[model samples]
Target: MTRRTMVFLAGFVAVAIFILGSIFYTKPAPDFAQGIGPGGDSVLVRPHSPILGPETANVTVTEFFDPMCETCREFFPLVEEIIGDHQGKVRVVLRYATFHPGSEDAVRILEAARRQNKFESVLFVLLEKQSEWAAHGEPNIARAWELAGEAGLDLPKAKTDALSPEVDRVIQQDLADAKSAGVSKTPTFFVNGKPLLSFGKQQLYDMVLAEVGQ
Candidate 1:
């Protein structure tokens, strides 16, 4: 073959290889609508995650929440309503995203509360009094602890537990999983492994309804 023709053929072959490689190797865009995208279902729910419904429930609503996030607080009741609406057919798994300054401490307290079987109560109290303790620039973590106490968490024991390595690990794992699952925003909901790409109460409800086949 002529030198010029050989050079051109080699260049064409390289270009063809590059194009084919990209087509075959490039990861496809995750189908968030399916709830089980590139991240898979394992990242969606963990055994340590706090579950709010029957374990055997057909539909699982996984929410990545930051304790100090106002949107998360607002959506708490809406999620509850969804569970109630579906009765035993739906469940919720709460995962910490701790995106705020004092949120890590808040989640520490929440983990402690979970150990004491006061997760829901402490969670509600924290959300209700979020404004008081979760100030924008300077959060009053002490007040948050006090509110947790009021919610039935034994302050002393909880304080000790909150500082445990296990709690820290949980927070770290949750954050890692959140990132892997493409959850950059608090109160991100995934119904039956399908993501609510659009943030809205009605949208989440619809996702749940569709997952539940209702």
Candidate 2:
């Protein structure tokens, strides 16, 4: 069962919960297929969105993820591998779809981590210990802070920055875009703005591979 297919089959149960909803390097400016990407008036790739790989890479994958979603955590390394496989040919654009309980605060922590240049560290830590802090029915918000601190984030500054209006703006933009883009699930994706017509790990891989060839 592909991740997307699995998500599709199980989505309703997850959605019944009333959800919610990374970067490697700089981009090099790869040519994008017209119309689907975050160009013109689109808002997926906002100013504060952390990007990995070169902007110039030919393939860009935009994912709407929830920091608290277990599925998102499962797929993180896969996404990392895809980008790594493509080297500078692929770039990832991450957006929020904060549906899970306590997810908003988690995202706030990530945004703050970005400010402190600890995004990669904090994100991995949170995901690594997701079950501990993001427990399904009872989110341990304080534990998340401790995990972030363990991830090398400067906790005091992270807390202050996480609550900033600027970070709020980042979250707000993602919320608006998620609605406008019709994204109702976490880890929803687009390749250079083109929706993933079908979902699967291989399908996801092929999408970017095809883009790389272009």
- Alpha carbon lDDT at 144, candidate 2: 94
Candidate 2 scores a C-alpha RMSD against the true structure in Å of 14.7
**Best prediction by TM-score:** 1
| TM-score, model 1 to reference | 0.82
Model 1, 138-214: lDDT tens digits are 88999999999888889999999999999999999999989988988898888876678778999988888888895
lDDT of 2 at 130: 93
Query: Cα lDDT of all candidates, in order?
Result: 0.86, 0.82
Worst 10 residues of 2 by lDDT: 31-40
Clashes of 1: 2
The residue-level lDDT of candidate 1 at 99 comes to 86
Global Cα lDDT for candidate 2: 0.82
